[model samples]
Target: MGKRDVDDDDDDDGGKRRKASGGFSDHAPPDDGQSAEIQLDQMLAGGAGLAGLGMGMPGMGMPGMGMPGMGMPTPGLSVPGASAAPELDPLKPATTPMDFSKLGANMPSQEFPVPRDMVEYLMTPEHRQILLEETGCDVDWAPDESKVQLKGSAEQIRKAQRLLQRVLMHCNWGRSEAKVRRLLKPKIIESAVLRLSPMNTLPAGQKTLSQTQPVISIGKDKKANDIVIPAAIVSRQHCVLELDIDRGAIYVIDCSTNGTFLNGLRLPPKTTGKVLVSHGDELLLQDPANDQEFGYVVNIQELNVREQTKLQAPRRLLSTEESATMGRDFQ
Candidate 1:
């Protein structure tokens, strides 16, 4: 037979078997080599179909195995673009600092000890207002009124403390209300001496007994006054130089016909009580008779020393036994 006639006869026989069976099946077993070749072809075709759909077997760079640009979801896994889950570490305890400031937590209060005399001054409305405006903090007084507690941030509390320190430093100088309010600088005086000088020429230092008062009077009378200016324009008690040993302050009381000019500012007679005389301050004796604008000028100098002497020596009352012994010794 011809090749075409033989192929037609095989096809007719396979079609008649398929009609009787009603489905595809092996009409008869092929040779071992042909069957093996057909199985190999089927596997290759299945693998190619899977690769085109962007899927593959395990460990073969599959799309679900995080291969480049394939973006397939894996089982039991969360997709991207979601909140990150927290990871807890089992080896170490958390040591993060808690922020209590935002929770309205109260911090430890800071207290500043103040002098008893200075408590009222520091608590004044003006000073308190200054503290609040500058430091953004307020203070509370202790029961004994000896110290103040400030509540705020660390920087604010520190600023408030410094303000108090400055107030103390200035207030320690002179406890006078006017002086403390002005916040004047303290004068570290060792030995303050007061004496009278002439209107024309200032006198040098004079020798005086220690028993006399630290004050030296100035006037027309040479015998009555500690030092005298013989000019007719001077008064009998023109002015008195007082040395305040306790306060470390010097003052001049004007009782003259014209007035006392301290630093060219007049302390008019019977009008102003007294004026402070600090180091480098000028004490001028105004002469009403003369039409001159200026007057007698005296320069004050605070003597420098290694140590300051006590303002007043200590004193004690004599006991009965000590008095009796002293009386017997005198007799």
Candidate 2:
């Protein structure tokens, strides 16, 4: 009886399995029907919006991140009517403010005569702007167009003047504009000499200072002086001459009861008033009306001329009658 039961159960299970297998063979089950290409297209379609949002690719960063040089738009959502990014102009010069640390302070205000040839080059707006901005100096062209007035502290003025000097020299040498701009720096005058010559007959015992002397004094005082000319017209403490070795320039300051004249023009009194004496300029001791009274011809020689060794020794050549007549005033 047990064998009989076992055989029946096996037969029933086998019949059920065969029936299930035959059902499936008649019609195939549903597949994951999407093909590779179709799946790829779906993914790309979703990524299209993300690409515009800069999210689909690596290193895209967040949308509207606006990181520097990141190729992203400004930091905000794009508006429908917003204007496009401005195109950079190619012709405009990029402005970088000048550094003022190098230009020191307390530069004295001064005026400079622009050489005739450099008037045009130095007067341009571009160069003038550079002077004002870089040197902290206010530069203006004189109405006559012959000079430029610089107003600033002494240090600034000196720097500006040096720049002008370099520019002018380079211009005379036919240097390019670019080259002139590159050669700017502080400069010093190596050596200098002042030559003074009497414009008229002097007293028999009168003497003038040597030209090689860095400084000279002129006055009516006969004792304790460098250049002594005994005349009633000149004040006891009339004027003095000074040499600026570093600047290669000569300055004449008037200190007189009467007056000190430059090229027949009266100079201002005391140190407050001074004039830069140029080569072959005259220093008249008295008024222009004093026809017979003498003055001095001032000649300033700089390092360039000094290098040539053409400087002459101080000498006085006078007639016998003039020498005899000169000592009468002192007596």
**Top candidate by TM-score:** 2
The prediction achieving the highest lDDT against the true structure is 2
Instruction: Provide backbone clash counts, one per model.
Output: 0, 11
Give the per-residue lDDT digits (tens) of candidate 2, residues 1-331.
Answer: 3333122223644643222321122333337776534643564466533344334344545333233233344443342455777666899987789989856445456788877666655576766777776677888887466898898877778767767765664344233434333333212334455567676685322222233555677776867457776778777867877653533345577777887777666775553334555556667777878663468776655553232111111224545664432211000
Model 1: per-residue lDDT, tens digit, 97-191?
A: 88766652475469899888876555666656656666677667773859888888887787667656655653433344444433322344435
Off by over 4 Å in 1: 1-183, 188-190, 194-212, 268-272, 287-295, 304-331
Q: C-alpha displacement of 46 in model 1, angstroms? A: 53
Off by over 4 Å in 2: 1-187, 203-213, 245-248, 304-331
Residue 298's lDDT in candidate 2:
65
Residue pairs with clashing backbones, model 1? none
lDDT of 1 at 93: 91
TM-score of 1: 0.35
**RMSD of candidate 1 to true structure, Å:** 18.3
TM-score of each: 0.35, 0.39
